[model samples]
Target: MTQSTPSAQRRSNLKHRAILDAAAQAVAQQGYAAVTIEGVAALAGVGKQTIYRWWSSKAALLVEVYSDLVSRQALTPRSNGSLEQRLTGLLSALFRLYRSSSAGAILTGLIGEASRDEQVRAVLAEGLVVGRADIVTALVQAADASLNAQAVNEVVIAVVWQRLVLQPDSLDEAFAQHLAALALAAGRLS
Candidate 1:
């Protein structure tokens, strides 16, 4: 069962979401090379110390922005259906969320920065684990029909993530629906 977020935690999450929005916009407009914690603070209308107090580095802020943006969008379903249909809708929703320029730009900047900063990469991976796990859990629920399924299911999702994030390809709704079908089938969740 999902636990409810405490009020204090919810309030803190709201503040951080605002910061992420501001930071994402700053990075999207100025480029990662130009982004600074001070600039993010200024754009966010918060003190520089506030940003520094919460995050260790610009890369860390970016990672949090990406993670927060992904996490805010709940992945649960409103109706029951075949796994293929459910996963198709979920992937399509993910595509729609990531298609936002602000969020996409933040993720792109982090990925680019990670190539040059091993420390940033490790930190980002650690920070993103929970959000990634949440996403994986949604996929797991949809692919739970078959025995010996999880390994194949993860591979399918790995491919979908690569196609959507790494490759120079669009993640249109049609593509998401198609990938979801393949992934669910590959997981033997027909």
Candidate 2:
């Protein structure tokens, strides 16, 4: 493999971050229906070919955008808290994130698009479901070694997704606490 010069690498990294940010902004402002590769290219001040050179499709770009956004912006659960507290902290962070950031719109768009697009659905299944589930599963195992990780993860995902998609209005600290308590109780039983 050819090595990239430090300057060239920096430039490429800047461009990549710009494209992801632009894609996120496009989705947030225009909704997923209107987020075209062309639109993202224009917003990022890059050529359409530049985007295509890096990502195979808009769905692929969106997956990267979601991952980058979550890594950079999503809140981390406290390491010191009780299992209930840690889970509550994590869910609350997610709720606050979805409520306050472009991530919310992007998530809604992904979910909506998944209904009709197999590519988007696959991306969601891998990125959102598995990614979020892994985090919760680890937290559940930490909380109670006897608890069923997969089952608890499913419950956590279900509760969060319901708040995100079905009842966004109810995504609050109280809801986060309730969801955490419910998950902990059910997890301990199983």
Candidate 3:
């Protein structure tokens, strides 16, 4: 088989980027349930086969899209603030993202899909759950070396998931503070 030339590689990369961007835009605008491979292909000006070559299902594509969104948003905590302040800031940013953007809708839809699809469930766990838990664990450990990172991570994830699913409208600054405090308290207790 012949190797791909540099120009051909660049074209492929461009198409891949376009597909991802189009997927993100479609999900954000139309929501996950409404988005389709055909629609994303039309938006990206690529054939559906191109997306199929990269992702086997919509859930897989969405997992990558949400991961990209998190990376672009820079939701991690900064080092300058105190532990409480940093945690609060991080939670607040997440809340704002969930409230004002497509992240919330995308995540909600993914969670629902995860229940029925084993592949989606595994991908979501590895990409979303583990990644966010690692961030929270790092922040907790950085703040208090003796604290139980796992405990804090669990509390943070639980609170965030609960609010995102049950009381999304309540995910504001005040709730952020409450969650931060609860995480710290749980860490201390653990």
Candidate 4:
């Protein structure tokens, strides 16, 4: 009946991250459906109750893992490039993030599984919307033309993520740059 102390909490947090990483690796290799709480606990060398105590479901566990895995690098626009070039660089960074093997597969699977889980959908919506809005806000603040900012952001994010999640083969950095250039041109005209 002893209470856990602050150091024990920190250790528990570290164990939680290890569990999440192990879960991500398992999901990357075995796909989402095959990764159970027990499997992740076994992978992380922790107790199943430890996992359940922190995360209610595998989707919750994977979402944090996916976010951390994909977002370790900052996705800021380049300072030395033209608006189009900066946008292209941004797109390329995003392209690489989502297209990275573990993050990409886990994201796709999570989105699919999120269809059945409202909590996962909410988390996805919050993360994605904040990210997209942040990009658009940065563009506007960086003087990426005032008109049609929303449209421009939509086209860039859509093209990048569509290619990342759906058209993995036909899409490349070239295509993303081309799309960004077109969106920027159109935004300037508007």
The candidate that achieves the highest lDDT relative to the unseen native structure: 3
Ranking by TM-score: 2, 3, 4, 1
lDDT of 2 by residue, 1-190 (tens): 9999999999989999899989988987888778999999999999999999999888778877877777776566789878888888888887777766677777777887888999889888887887656788887776678888887778887777666788888888899899888987777787
lDDT, candidates in the order shown = 0.69, 0.82, 0.86, 0.74
Error of 3 at 37 (Å): 1.7
How well does candidate 4 score on lDDT at residue 86? Answer: 80
TM-score on alpha carbons, each prediction: 0.75, 0.91, 0.91, 0.79
Clashes of each: 0, 0, 0, 0
lDDT of 3 at 62: 80
Task: Encode model 4's per-residue lDDT on 108-186: one tens digit a residue.
Answer: 7767766788887877666664544666557755674465887777776566556656776656689767987888766
Local distance difference test, candidate 1: 0.69
Ranking by lDDT: 3, 2, 4, 1
Model 3: clashing residue pairs?
none
Q: Could you report the Cα RMSD, in angstroms, for every candidate shown?
A: 5.6, 1.7, 1.7, 3.1
Residue-level lDDT of model 1, residues 76-188, one tens digit each, is: 54356766677678777767777765556666666667778898778766776444655545555654745334544565556655664576357778887787667656666
- Cα lDDT for residue 108, candidate 4: 73
lDDT of 2: 0.82
